[model samples]
Target chain A: MRKFIWTLVIVAVVAVFGGRAWYLHKQAEQNKDAIKIGVVVPLSGFDENMTDRIVTTLKTATEELTKKKPYKIQYLFEDGKYTVKDSISAFNKLKASNPSAYIVLGDLPAFGLRPLINETKMPTIVLVSGDSGLPAQSPYLFRMSLSSKDMIQRLASFTYNTKHISDAAIMKIKNNYGDDGSQFFKKYFADLGGKVIAEETFNVMDMDVRAQVEKVLATNPNMILVWGFGPGYTTTFNQLSELGYKGEIITDFGVFDKAVWENIHNKGDGIYFTTIDSQANKMNPQFLQNYTAKFGDKPDVVASFAYAAVEALLKTIENPKGIEAGLYELQNFETAIGKINYDKEGEPHAQIVIKQMQPDGTAKIVKE
Target chain B: MTYVLHQLIMISIYLILVYATNLVTGLGGLMTMAQAAFYGMGAYVYALVALNMPVGFVASCGISLLVAGLVAWILSKVVLRFRGETFVLATLAFQMIVFTILDNWEGVTGGSYGLSEIPRPSLFGWEVSTVPEYVLLSVIVAALITGVFWVMLNSPFGLSVRAVRDNERAAESLRISPQKQLSRAFVISSVLASLAGCLFASYVTYIDPTSFSLTESIFILCILLVGGSGNIIGPFLGVLFMILFPEGLRFLGLPDESAANLREIVYGTILIVLMYYRPNGFKGIYSVK
Candidate 1:
């Protein structure tokens, strides 16, 4: 009797799981007109809001692009679950979907799937990113995102050239991004004749970094390049108070999440960041208006690029011909983000922006 | 040649782990989920020592054994209560505790970025830098460990453990303390696990927390159970199946996006089928005693 009950339970569990998987497989086969572009993003994970904007912008841009074009660009969004394995799984699913090109839209964990991406022989593009440092390179991979190497060099140059900040301390998430960014900043900051007193790391999810901040405080840096992400950044200032380490907290565009500013501490004035998009840019008023009307909010760096991606794709396929025409036309198309100059590699060289936060939690571009 | 060598080294590592686990869960009436914690310790120790200290072959082996023994002693003391489900839960707590140390303790362990570019291991004026040489060393060590397990299991000490496992109350009445027997089995098992971990770390030339998780503990146990635990040749056969499943996944060659996940589904399905059809295992003694 016990054996029979156990057997029945196992069979029922298998039946349900098997049913769901089969339905998904069948759905893919039915969508014949759709050209599924696999989009691995962090929609429900730590970078949820950012990915939400990016995915939405991409969808909207695709619709707009399709209306202006002969063929429709269909995207299949896959949440990476904020993990390397899931990213690989998403890549595998895209390959299994028999898509034209599986896109590594955002999320640095996408590097973990580089080997599988390379094996697919399909073109893959990355947006503005910090490195996770898993795979060094792949033929199929093309990243227009400012590489860690480039970002650090530019940061060092900017820091040394400026007379405002003399001494800089470093605090980063204790991952590949932090490791590379820290090392890069350390080497270049010193090479550029800048003094870096201390380099420390905090767990990206750690709400309290008072211990590490105390040591960095003891160094008495004039400013701190406090590299962090997600909710961790909001807690950073709190940890600063506990440690009594008050200095300028400098960060990058990646940490400019909506959740960061929604909190009180993150809303503080004079918090400087180097990002790409300007929410109040008079030049791209149409973009700002349209994005706000649709998304009900201002788009961040990822949303702008993701929005640009769909815009680029639609404009590429403007004519009724084929992929060749789309490819050729995209070479000349302009996006609100910047010019879309896609090589055979599909890399778009876009301009990045630097913005500073106001006391009211709004970031205005620090005009050079 | 390198590929062949890699497989041999992999086989050796699995061999030691399987035997170690088999001794605990197979011969003794106790289950453990903290094997991966011990494995992680060995890897981290080797990574730190290789980077910082003068570590020779003997030194590496000694350190691995010492770390395992210490972890086992501490764990056994804490988890000796509640033998069935609670015991499983306790070891799970141990696994989580170890993971916390690895993930949160970044300053010392390098956290999630992992310790990379580990120095190649050398022994007695002979360095096994290449794949084939490492394979030879791994296989020789594996064979010796297996031989020791083989002898130990056949000894009177092994008989007492099995007696206690089969009937704990009866064995206790006969003067064999269940606690002491289980603890001894656990320590020996941990040593074997840690030794394999040391070799794995040295071979990969890196150590990370991701490599050792509670999932890994389940995987090692699956090998022994799927091959029919408690009897001779069970753990060995189980190890073969475990490696073969992944290699089979490689052959499917699904698309980039679906290949990895589909392979995982397939792997899980195989385990499920095996458990259903052959609960005693793929190669258990069929005597209806």
Candidate 2:
């Protein structure tokens, strides 16, 4: 009796997994005619709101595109949870869906899937701001977001030339994004004859950055550059305000996250951030209005990039050339973020602009 | 087919890791929280050697094991002085120290940007580049490690370690050096973990500090706890349940918006219920005190 029960349990376990796999395989077969795009994004963990926006924007764009296009497009999303292991798992799970192309968010996911991308030779679009140079490593990999080098160049130029800031301190998250921002800002700022007086780092899970903030303030630099993502930025901003240092503050487009500004409240006002050009909004005037009306919230730069990825993929599908060749042939492709151009290295060159946060938790372009 | 291969490879790598954890925590009865650190050490060392040196995959893995073993030996010397929760805390501190080094050592480890473009494992002109090839390599490695562990555990050395685990005073009365045996188990456990790390780095061809965080250490410990420890079959059961079951949840076709969270919830709940019903795990002989 005991032996029979154990056998039954084992059979049941296999049946559950086998049943699900068969169901998904059948579904994939049924949708064989549709162009499947696998999207890996963080649906949990840090930056959930940001990924939620990406999903919403992708769905909205795909819905609109499918209605007008000749061929149907299908997007299958897998939750990467913004980590390397989960991203790889998500990618593998999405493979069962039989996607022709893939879209991975963040540097970690792109990096994790780099080897697999090479192995599979699937055309993948990576939406990442950090200048990790991953897109250049794989021919099939194309980057959709602005590079950190370009954004830091503009920020450094503005800090030195426009604002006349002679020295700055950096408080950055201790990851690829933070490392790139700090490294690039230092290099560009030094080239522009400005000095980085001090640098402090904190982990993403760190809730209190008072120690790091205190150290940065101790340097007494003319401007402070804060580079990070997620809710941690709010803590940094609030702590900076608590420290009561009267100096200029600057960050990246990550500051535009609603969770950050709303939590930081008025503390985020007067801070400048480098982001994709506001011309992106001007090019698609209806995007902001439509996104707001549908989602009941404003779309940030990340949403625009996500929407643009869908647009770029659609263009590739429409082209007579294949995914890889079509991607390279794309020139001045219209997207929510204005016109995007892909260089020979598969990295998209988009205009970057500096914007200042308003007291009402909105950003306005800094007029040069 | 490729996805199945990928999961198999991952399971193989994690099986080695769980075996490493099970050796010290299950048999030696010294709960460790630094498996991921040793794992990371193995990966980084393997990546560095592979990228910079002319060494092949075997040599890289050998060097990684040597380095991780040395660190584990040194760590064992310090952490072995403590017992129970204090020992666990010491191991946890070591984990944090290693993570900090990996995160901040920009010049060498590439810091948080991580070391990318890691070459696939090649042994004397035989490369494990393809997914199926990697699956085969990983499975062979996992099997060899399992065989070695079985031999080690069934030997007199294993009996002495278990004796010390059950009662250190009684084992010492029997002339079994508790400190020496435990240290050996710890070092051996860590070296095996580093081996898994090497396979993972070469397999993924990319690794960052985030891959070897404290969370991972806790997860490895959880695997041993849930699968049962202090025995050979326990680690295998733990690996299958801890790694594959959560992955199997992905196929449930849950709504995308809540799928990740839902999977986590269901997984967590099952673990809790399992522990509540079977405190020592499915096949565990010794539970952590």
Candidate 3:
């Protein structure tokens, strides 16, 4: 009798957990006609406000697509909390909720997720930019955000081909994004016949860039490349001006915000940044206007990236071949961020525009 | 399901960490926060050894054990000189120093980008690659560590450690060397933490500075305190509550925008209530003063 009771208890335990799993799987199956997109972002942490805008854009994109398309679309957003562990946890929960998602949208560094992505074979679109090494590690992973390597390469090419700078110096943050960018810039710039005279690094939370700036200034290079994000990106440029260096300064789209320039008293004249053409508010005027009216602020780069990722995912699902048809199949696809294409490795093949901040604190497109 | 197996693997790792922390903080009466540092040290040591050396995963684990144990011994010798708050401060300082080294030491530790492409653990030509296989390995490792800890707890050394915890002066009066007992406990706990780290690195196949940050140490401490760790089973209970509480919030039907914060608030509230009502924990033998 005791043995029979033990067997019953074991069976009951399995039935409870197994029933929950079956219910979840059944719910997922009911929405077979809908294309499910799982989004993971820092919704309640350091980048919460910025992520709110992205979420808003995601909602608007989905709503607009649902109104136009015959099939319904579903989205599940989870908080990554700006950490790799939390991101993985969020991804797991999202995956459990929908076992057969078309694609997952994530906005964290992709170092920790590569192994899992390789194992699961789930096509994920990464928003955070850096040295993902995705092409070599996991082919199913697609980087929707602009690549830091590509940004540096474009900056290097522009410096060599257009500015005719033979010598350069780089100031980067002492993290993966900066390290990868610095390495890529040096190699690409050197291969393009330019010499990097000096390279220095600063921590992300560091307020003091004077020592690094001074070290780079001592090199007396014709051009300077700065790799950083947030307000600190402008700090390198300000410190350079304070030291009276007159070299052309280059950075990524992280410094494209006019608010960043306004924060600095010096205005850091002659500093340029690489950005997508969508920042000009030339494409998708209706969507931009709607976003501005809704949020009282224009949709920034974060929103643009979110919109483009959703657009790409929607298009890929419509292909009937899914993401496996290869992101390259969406050749010259017109996205919210203008004409965009992808190479065989899922990297966007698009135009990178350079914008320079004028002495008056206004930025104008310099190179397209 | 793979999801359940994944959660189980994570729980096993946390269980090991919580058990190690309990050995020192719960029984040895030391408020040390350097477990995360030892854990990261073991992971980095394993990753570097496995990748650079021609040694297999077992050899890498052995090297990690030796490296982490030695470092823990050296750290205990230096920090155990102080008692109470000063000792806690020393551990905090050591934690910060370790974190800084891990973040800045790009040459060996891979800096903040983290070490990736870590090969999966293989046991005697059997590759533990699949989720179920890794889960089984995790359970076995956790069980082995627990078994070793259980044996030690039933021995005279465990009684000495607890005696030192109850009253160091009394233990000394009873001819027990308080310093020796404390140091032994600290070293044992730190080595076990390193073992847990090796399992973590092998299972996750990647790690970063953030994983071994001060936040993680505090989280492990929460597992001990909230679980009311004074006995062997206390750490298991603590690990279960801490791991499952936050995860349980996923089913609350909360919006994504508020889910993370709400989960923290709920988890914190439950812990506070538990500490107030049941300070000795559910199955703990002693209450934290």
Superposed model 3: Cα runs more than 4 Å off = A1-32, A99-109, A159-169, A189-200, A206-224, A230-248, A257-270, A279-286, A358-362, B52-56, B269-289
Best by TM-score: 2
**Candidate 1: which stretches are off by over 4 Å?**
A1-30, A105-108, A132-136, A241-245, A264-267, A278-295, A311-333, A339-349, B1-33, B38-208, B211-289
DockQ of 2: 0.56
Better of 1 and 3 by lDDT: 3
What are the clashing pairs of model 3?
none
What are the interface RMSDs of all the models? Answer: 9.0, 2.9, 4.5
Better of 1 and 2 by TM-score: 2
What stretches of model 2 exceed 4 Å from their correct place?
A1-30, A278-290
Please give the CA lDDT of all the candidate structures.
0.69, 0.87, 0.78
Better DockQ candidate (2, 3)? 2
Sort every candidate by DockQ, greatest first: 2, 3, 1
Predicted candidate 2 versus true structure: per-residue lDDT over B110-219, tens digit per residue: 99888988999888788887889999999999999999989988899999999999999999999999999999999999999999999999998899998998999999
Every candidate's DockQ is 0.12, 0.56, 0.28
Pitting candidate 2 against candidate 3, the one with the higher lDDT is 2
lDDT of 1 by residue, B1-289 (tens): 3333555677788888888887878887567788788788787877777777776756876886898798798778878756877888998899888977886688878876667656667888889787678888889988998788888887877878888878889989999888888888888888888888888777766566766878788878778778876766877788878865664554443443454456667888988998889887888542111
Per candidate, the number of residue pairs that clash is: 10, 0, 0
Tens digits of per-residue lDDT, candidate 2, A1-368, equal 99999999999978976887788789768777888889999888776777778887787767766676678777899888888888888888788777889998888888888887887799999885576476788899999898877788889999999999989999888788888889999999999999999999876767899998998898888899998876566788889899987899988888887777678887889999988763444424455566788667666788878878877888888777788789898788777677788888888888778899998887889976
* Maximum-lDDT candidate: 2
Looking at candidate 3, what is the lDDT of residue A351?
63
